[model samples]
Target: MEDALWAQLQNTGLEEHDDKDRIEAESDDEEVDVQEELSVPHEERLQGPQTGPKGVKADHEYHQQKKLVTESKARAEYNARLLAKAPMTTTYLQDEANKDREELLILQAEEEEEDDLKYYREKRLRELKNMSRQQRVFGTLTTITADEYADEIDEEMGDIPVLVHLFDESIPTCKLLDEHLRGLSNKYSLAKFIRVSALQLEFDLVESPAILVYKNGILIANLVRIIDEVSTRFDIDEIEDVLTRHGALSENDLYDLPTNYA
Candidate 1:
């Protein structure tokens, strides 16, 4: 009986020792598997959690959506900054346009002022020249002797019409003619008038108050015994008509006279 009991105890001890060795071997194998898993790269480790193709596709889609959301947020921030500066940019452009328009208006005004000044300056110059020309022309009748006839009537005539009256101072008709001629000289300033003694030219007293007209140093008309050729008692109008008919005087000649004279 004692040997049987001892044999049973020895068998139980051996079985316990074999069980401990088997447990130790299984624990060492699990430790080697964990070390190999840790030694793999990080990418393989990340893929290790995926069960199949569906999980891998789902993960790829998740990362793609995340990237799209990040890009959308960056675009929204850029648009927000641009919108904030829009008002200032529009205002700056409008101000530049207004400044350019004002400068153009100022330039146009200056050009108009310059044109007005030029117009008035030219008008004043024309008026001055007309005044100077009037001052140089003869405005009244002048007396001349027989010796001065060539110098007074011919040499100084130029393109002007010259009227010479050969008169006897003693005759009443001749004296009347001189008064009319003096008035005519002041009225028709463009024409030259002069008188000389009839006796100086050895003319008869019966043919006294003879009239002669000259133009450009050429004798154009001669009237002897003028009181008989025209009306017996003629006024200034009849004499002026006779001179105008003979081409010695013209209506156009009155334009050179002053406006107040007429």
Candidate 2:
């Protein structure tokens, strides 16, 4: 009986060993089959994008737009830490505030300079542009029929030109002279443009349109019928030419020419 029991025990041990070996062999086969079926071909993977949704872009461009947002979040956290009133943060905040103040002052100064330029340009444009018939017909010309109360010509500030046009007749030529003088008033804001009749003049004048230019209370030129000689249809340029030639005025320097008594 003892021998039979021992024989049974030995057979059972042998059977257990065979079972273990079979299981291990089956597991190896399954592992091989899984690897063969689940893997992609190397060539197929090479044909597509390298990795992720990035589509093979440079490392720098990856999450580039989001970098700003993340950086902003980090800055906000840093600012919060600084405002928490630690000693180092207090020093950093004070320095940052001083830097910000300096930047603000620089920006303010630049803006003021820009505003000055803008004002100068606008003023120049208003003086030069859109000078048509209506605008040309009437301007800042001072009219003196006889001897009015008083004019600013006597108290002439600087070497500003005092142009007195003697046009008494109500004829077409006198009217044209009036139009020309009116246009000049707009162009030459620094100079005084005056229109006086024969009744106002001390000297006896025969011609209709006579112009007398004075500077610093001194006589410059007494022009007679020069407009009638220049052209029948006298425009602004011809008159400007005459004035520039006579040294009464030249091209307007806008801001450069000191108001000279403005």
Candidate 3:
């Protein structure tokens, strides 16, 4: 009986031992599954390309990433090229605009300068022409003496027709009448206007300045040298009476005189 009991105990212990071994074996199997999941991807990378549509999709994804990277690089290069050209374009445009403005200003200034030069040239020409005309006219005068007109002076101015003489004080002939003709001009109303000079002919004489009338062709009277306030020397009415008696101072003999002394 003891031997049997000992054998039964041994059998029970063996069953428990077998259960522990089975449990240990199952734990080892789970550990081996986890290890295989972790290590398998490395094995597959070494094994090279996969199979079916899954392999194709993975390849497509890789190519898509490559295509995106290439497109990004090309865009960056194009942007850099545009940036480099921008400053040159702006500078060229600015320079061209400045040149156009400068040219326009220069053209306007030249036009104004040309106009001023033309005006000055024309004004100088006019002045020169006027000077030439005056010189030509003044060149034609002739000299005269008092003795040549002595008979005409006495006959016309002495007794019958009272005359008022207008002569240049500087001339020797005019100086001869200094003692004879004094204060006679203020007494005459219908008087002769005379100019006697060798240089200028502003009034009537072809050669001047000389004794002449204010009107160019009307010979109403001639300027002669007579001394004294002659109307008072002989009362103007008495002189008129004398003049009328001698066929002078007639109504038809009178003419218009120049009022402008200048």
Measured by lDDT, the strongest candidate is 1
lDDT of each: 0.76, 0.66, 0.46
lDDT string for model 2 (78-103, tens) is: 99887786754457789999899999
lDDT of 1 by residue, 168-226 (tens): 97888898888887777767777788888888878786845888889888888777676
What TM-score, over all chains together, does every model reach?
0.46, 0.43, 0.23
Q: List the residue pairs that clash in candidate 3.
A: 180-227, 181-226, 181-227, 182-227, 182-228, 195-210, 197-209
Candidate 2: misplaced stretches above 4 Å? 1-139, 148-151, 202-205, 252-262
Scored by Cα lDDT, where does model 1 land?
A: 0.76
lDDT, residue 24, model 2: 100
The segments of candidate 3 whose C-alpha lies over 4 angstroms from its true place after superposition are: 1-89, 92-108, 115-215, 219-262
Query: How are the candidates ranked when ordered by lDDT, highest leading?
Result: 1, 2, 3
Q: Give the least accurate 10-residue stretch of model 3, judged by summed lDDT.
A: 135-144
On TM-score, the candidate that comes out on top is: 1
Segments of candidate 1 deviating more than 4 angstroms: 1-136, 205-207, 255-262
Clashing pairs in 1: none
